[model samples]
Target chain A: MIRADETESTIVPRIEVGERLEAGFEWFEDTFDSAINWVGSTVAYISDGLAEILAIPDALILTVILAAIAWLVRNWKLALGTVGLMLFIITVDQWNEALETLALVAVAAAIALIIAIPLGVLAAKSQIASRIIRPVMDLMQTMPALVWLIPALAMFSLGMTAGIFATLIFALPPGVRFTELAIRQVDAEVVEAGHAFGSTPAQILFRVQLPLAAKTIMAGVNQVIMLALSMAVFAGFVGAGGLGTEVVRAISQLNLALGFDAGLSVVMLAIYLDRVTAGIGGGEGVLAKLLRRRKSAPVQTEETAEDKAATGSPTT
Target chain B: MTDTASNNVAPAVSVQNAYKAFGRRPQTIVKRLKEGATRDELKSQGMAAVIDASFDVAPGEIFVVMGLSGSGKSTLIRTLNGIQPPTDGTVKIFGQDITNVSPRQLRSIRREKIAMVFQHFALMPHRTVGQNAAYALEVRGISRSDREKKAEEALNMVGLAGYGGSFPHELSGGMRQRVGLARALAAETDLMLMDEAFSALDPLIRKEMQDQLLELQQQLGKTIVFITHDLNEAMRLGNRIAMMRDGRIVQIGTTEQILNDPANDYVAQFIQEVDRTRVLTAGEIMEPPVAVLGAGQGPRAAHRLMREHQTSALCVVDQTRHLQGVVYEDDVAAAVAAGAEGLTGLLRQMPATLPGTLLAELIGAASQHAAGLAVVDDHGRLHGVIPRVTLLNALADTSAEGAVRTILEEAPA
Candidate 1:
């Protein structure tokens, strides 16, 4: 290896790529100032509305409702676990911040899905659309979640709106990708059957494709929500309030106690949301299975009786 | 149903010079084909799924298109329903040219007039059997109660009456196919396209389904175009069978016509693999009785007729051609020697077979008696007779030489 001081040789000239990118961002901000502001306000309104609604219910009452939902959708075990997690958050005095975080994730994931699903459907239905959307989704997903906060902060300033904006971009790719994959993976023969019966393209998409793709799409929803939750923590750098703010505060002050409490709360929330969403996606949870069995009991008996009668006859 | 008026009625389905090529630019492939390019020459451009196919299916007739996989039979059936439009030529459903119809118009035609059954029982997994059966009507925007009622009736027709509430995955493969059949039946369309509908079922279940379909056809008289690779299935179900090879239909005819007089070597070889005993009917193989003695004639006349025909037995029929019985040579001689005046006393009961009875069922009865079995119609009128020799000959004649000779005899000069 040659010493740097021994020779002066330049193999390649330095490029102004970073300057051009910065200029591009400035130009975009300048050109779309009003549009960006309008979007920011809209996002702020949604997040604020959700946060207010979450705040209205007493924490205990909300916890009980959520636990009940968990029981109905999953099992008693998950419900009990949710109760324990909620109590822990309350005990640590992080309940309000946890709720704010929940509201932020809900808003981000909802907005992301509303846009992603249709784009996914369009991509799945048309080859040209798929080719165009795939690379963009790749770029969105592969780019660091922290990178999105830069543009978001520039557009919305330091607020919940900027946090939601970053989280929405961070969470959107899986929603679009999984939706497109799920729709495309639907049985071709089934789709053909739909067409054979003279169903319109819209009817087939709604009736056949969507129903079959429901479970997979639900998995995508889970991924979006989880991603939004993770990205919301990083949004604390922009002064977005929530558990993320506490986390930022603990990090800056080197308060280990605050860090542990906020981290535990995030983990608990993640686990609760993940299990509930997964149970919904998998379908036929313990309670659901029991209910379905009870409902179909009479039909099952009738089917067996008919089967016996069929076997008894020699005509076959 | 009069023969003369039948000519004026439009065929339920018609394809004239229809060709389907699979690729982005199917029209160019079709153009090359019409310009006398062979399938191999155009292989690089696209796959020619169907080439110059033409046929007509009459109302209430089962027209089967038979071919192995990749022979374009599936593609051909799809064209009838406009699932895959032909690259060239015309397709007509009930005399309405579908080739040029707008997509909306074609869809309405499928909704109102046509139904299809898939080989794989492409039923919606999420839907219950009843819901799956009701799907066609549902797509047509029929009321839920009305479509459900129709679906229930169709389910009953296929012997799946009470299983409508069950999901498809819960049912056996055969039962799932019943749901598929019920779906089509509920549509109540005059035309049905069955793309190897029973191909996925167990052999026993397939036979049962075939029987039920024939029984239903007897009552409903729906015009059907059935696609299958099995020659036996084609022979059993088709009123007219079209045999395809390499995207081209080589022959189209009734079962007997195709069996006894194949159009080409490929068809000849195809029929050779079919179990002749099961496919050939009594009427198809039976010959005219050697000689018939009128029931009013004397024993002497019966003996004389037997002698004149050089036969061991003779069929005795009334003036209306109703079969009385058979008078063997020995019985007639004994009656004549005993001075019997009429042939009735000497007539012996003989086993009779219906014209539609399969030869496999007649082999045991035909072998025990040397005189042969009498072939009769529903009215017990004598149609023909099947001698033991003819039965044996028919079964053994599936040899390559015999098949070649038959093909040669049927070939045009």
Candidate 2:
């Protein structure tokens, strides 16, 4: 065996890839500064509006409304968890920051989905689009969440707007990938059946493919929401105020108790959002299933409740 | 032939020189670009699913296309409706050339003229039986209430009444197939293309469905192109059967004609395993009665007739050739010894059979009657007779010699 030193085995780089990437970012920041600011401000407007709306009512009243929504959308267990988590954040004096984080996630996820789903459908429908979008998606996913903030801070100044812009970009790849996959996964025989029945191509897409792919698309939405929530702390580095700012403040001051409270509140909020979206994706939500049942107007099977929890995902 | 000659109208479906090959274009191009590639080399790059398939179906006829798996029968059916477009051919449906029509025109033709039934009951898993049946009507822009009404009628016709509210998964395999049938029936098109529609069913259910389809066809008189791999089914339902082998139709004729004169060794080997009992009717196997003694003749004439014909029994028929009874040689001898003047003293009631009775059905009658089973016309006149030896020969013969014997026996005497 030969012993080797870390510096002795290395060779000098000719291309300097990292420097070139930094230069590329600087060029993009200089060239598209106004366009980036406009997008950031638009995202900021939606996020601020959502935050103001969520923060208006008393903490108690807000908790009651959220618990009611959880009950209607999910079940009794999720409703109780929502009520408990909201009260815990309020008791720890982190209610305002928690709502801010929630609003940021909601706006970022909404925009990401709005853009990603159409691109994904385009990719699924055409081979050229699919070949082009795949490698771009891989790059978006493989890059670090914090790396997105650098460009955001360069183009849009330090604030919640920049934070939201970065978080939206960081959490977009899953939406596109899963949407394309869901559309591609539809059974070919079902599509052929549609054609055999004399359906137009557009009719086949709307009636057959979209309805069948709905559950998987909802799963993709759940992924987008979860990713946005996870990226909040990274967004805090650029002065995006929320629970993340509190954690940063606590850490700088070496206040363990404060840091613990803020971190625990973030975890609680993440769980609440995660479970609600997952329930929706799995078709376990009472409201969606009830609506579907009403349209068909058949005798309801007892296995529906069980089927809802069992499908859409196998990992759980 | 004369019945068909009187009608100068066009055929219901005519496929001319149809060819379908399966593979991507780039692969064939790459193979063609190779050095010193021969014609066979380029041919090997793509699979020929159907090669120059051509056939004509008369109006209101059950034209069965029969083949083993991979023989391109399904592909041939798909080409009739433009589901799988032929590489080079013209398919005319009700005198309209499908290749010359626009996609919109073809779609309208499919909606108005042709309906198809699938093998695996290609029903929407999410829809109810009635909603699945109404799918074609929904595509045609019919109102929901009207679609439901027509779907209910179709379901009732298929003996699935009151099943409108049931989902497809809630039904058995046979019932799901009936829903598929009901879907096709609801369209009420001039032509129906059934691609192994009953092949997925259990044997008993398949038999019942075949009978139901036959009865419905008799009443509806719709021109149907039925494709199946089962020789028995082809024989049972087809007005004219086309035997396909390796993507080509080897022979096209009635069941009896095909059995008697196969076009080639492929068709001969294809039908070698077919059960003759199911495929042969009494009319195909029944022989002319050996001796017939008129009712006005005496027992001496009956005995003399039996002796001359070298048979033990003679049929007693009226002056109009309507059968009255059978008299054995022993009975005739006894009557002759008693000095009987007429054949009525020696006459015994005959065991009669319809000309359309299956040979399988006649086996029990032939064994029980001891003399023979007499094939009778509707007017009670004896057409032919199936002796014990003939029934045994039909059940025992596996060689093509049996076909030759049938032809010889069926010839005018």
Candidate 3:
């Protein structure tokens, strides 16, 4: 008997999926040449501007500012850790490159969120939209991340613009998926209550659904930022400058020291962004606790004074 | 029973042959239902939540839709507010047809004419109790200060005055439901829909909430459609209750009528465990006074009337039937022996109750006197009398069959 694999290969005609994809890419480039060029130049300008702004502050002062934010949002331990990691990057002369990577990741993630959130909301509200979007999102996520660079390179050529475009696509699915999940997970009775009170669809979305889904949506935002950071490093393969360039160069040349230093800098940056974003998402950061205490302080004092007055004497 | 067409005054809510089915093809299911298909026969096609329900709620009347889970009472209430428009038939609120209205008009009608209290409290977790209470008014585009003022007043009405600043998570379950009630009340709508509003609370809290709702109803006089699975709650709060089973309304009647004359086995079975003593009123069981003595009648006449009626005592009343006092036969005989002229000398004070007093409360008063309790109107006119034996029979007639038999055997023609 013939083997099952051999029989399958002989019976089915091989489809030229790879060739079709290449032709599709070429057609898109030819059709949207001007639009692609405009987007590329705009993204490049914004990334360059952000890099220059991030570079203006002295490295030490910038590190201090970041550490201070970590302390306020997180804790002293995280702040100290951030200071150590950032200082090591500065010592290794990777601070400027790290800032550039930061700029690239920031721009890509912001744009991804701007597109994904509304799509997610639409998907959550309408069954047809959800059905259509879910399969597309699945395809986007499951497709090899590197495959996106091929079309991105053809459309924008080489540079940070191409890097950002690839990174944007790579980071998009989670934002959409998580947002849809968050909104859909809101209690049905709560939504019914909104409708019962005569709230319009828009009002219910903004006032009831969004507020209740805030923490979950913020978790989606954290995932987007993390994905953007990882993809920005991958974008370095297509001439996107920053720590990614160093990493690519070190990898090609097989220089162990350069590779190790660049890789560590990327790790430090990822940890900082992840922790800060997680604190914002989880809602029990040190700063929040302090603020809540401060808000309740006056009420406690007023209550005590009222109690004394009500008892026919003001002891204090 | 429905006065939608017959009455000159428009009902607060009028539902006509409303049918709601849940599935991809609700219309097909509704059509099948109309063609005489039973709910079980069409079960695979769609779940018929409500089938051909029709009712009219008069203004200021508490119309209760009561059923067990999966009986479509909740679905029926939703049709009134246009939250879930029925698959077939029309719904009107104060004479305006809502079934065919646009979304904007439906929302406007909800904002202007209707407010709703939910089962699970449904208070927003992110908002403070005050903000939750103000939600309905905020949706109506009321000014912040005005809505806040109204919300505070509503909270005060629900006895949650100082808890407004607290978040819903900080409040107890009962308090959260109070905030839910305050939210509906602050809307100031003429019509309110409550879907099992007290079902989630503890027994004690549920009873308190029910009493508060009744008190609020007395003050506000809002037309309310209350949905509940608990028959006792329906009897306690509803002016008229519609009993539902398997997506169909089985019967609609007052508590007395339903208890004495159930339309079907389902309603009888449904109300099997209802505490009849709590549900029935003294007026329902009271009989016309056997032999009423005029205040101008002498003690001898009272004694003679008591003997003629075979009663131990006679109620002395004015010419206009205003209850003066009860004259016992022994006292009348004593007065007669002492040569007293008027019943005034022999008349003794008797406990009087309003017609609406529940028999549970009258049992104690009924037990205290040989003459039993007097059922009186607001102006102290004697409507009827509940003798001790009648009170005991009414209390013992807890089962629906026994109640019907007792009413038939004992009720005067």
- CAPRI-style docking class of model 1 based on DockQ: acceptable
Q: Which residue runs of candidate 1 sit more than 4 Å off their true CA positions?
A: A1-24, A286-316, B1-8, B288-297, B308-310, B317-324, B343-345, B377-381, B402-413
Candidate 2 residue runs with Cα over 4 Å from true position: A1-13, A16-38, A294-316, B1-9, B26-44, B281-358, B370-413
The native-contact fraction of candidate 1 is: 0.38
DockQ for every prediction shown: 0.33, 0.20, 0.33
Candidate 3: residue B368 Cα off by (Å): 2.7
iRMSD per prediction, in order: 8.7, 9.8, 9.2
Cα lDDT tens digits, model 1, A267-308, are 989999999999888775766565444223124354553443
What would the per-residue lDDT of candidate 3 be over residues A1-316, giving only the tens digit for each residue?
A: 7543344466686666778889987898899889889989999999999999999999999989889888888888888988998999998889999999999999999999999999999999999999999999898888888889888888888899989999999999999998999999999999999988889999999999988887899899999999999988888899989998999999999999999899999998999999988887776767766644322211334354233223311110
Quality of model 1 by C-alpha lDDT:
0.87
Report lDDT (Cα) of residue A291, candidate 1: 43
- 1 or 2, greater by DockQ: 1
Q: Per-residue CA lDDT of candidate 3, range B1-413, in tens?
A: 32223566678888899999999899999999999999999888889999999988888888889999999999999999988899999999999999998999999998888999999988898776667888898899997667767887787799876565667888889989999999999999999999999999999999899989988998999999999999999988888889999999999888877887789878777667888888777777889886899988898787778777788888888999999989887888889899988766677888999977788888777777899888899899998998898888776645534435445777788
| Candidate 1 chain B lowest-lDDT run of ten | B1-10
| lDDT-superior candidate, 1 or 2 | 1
Kindly give the number of clashing pairs for every candidate: 0, 0, 0
Instruction: State every prediction's TM-score relative to the real structure.
Output: 0.91, 0.81, 0.91
Candidate 2, A25-131: lDDT as tens digits: 88987788788777777877888899999999999999999888788778988999999999899999999999998998888899899988988888889999999
Cα lDDT tens digits, model 1, B108-159, are 9999999999999999987777779889999999977777778878988998
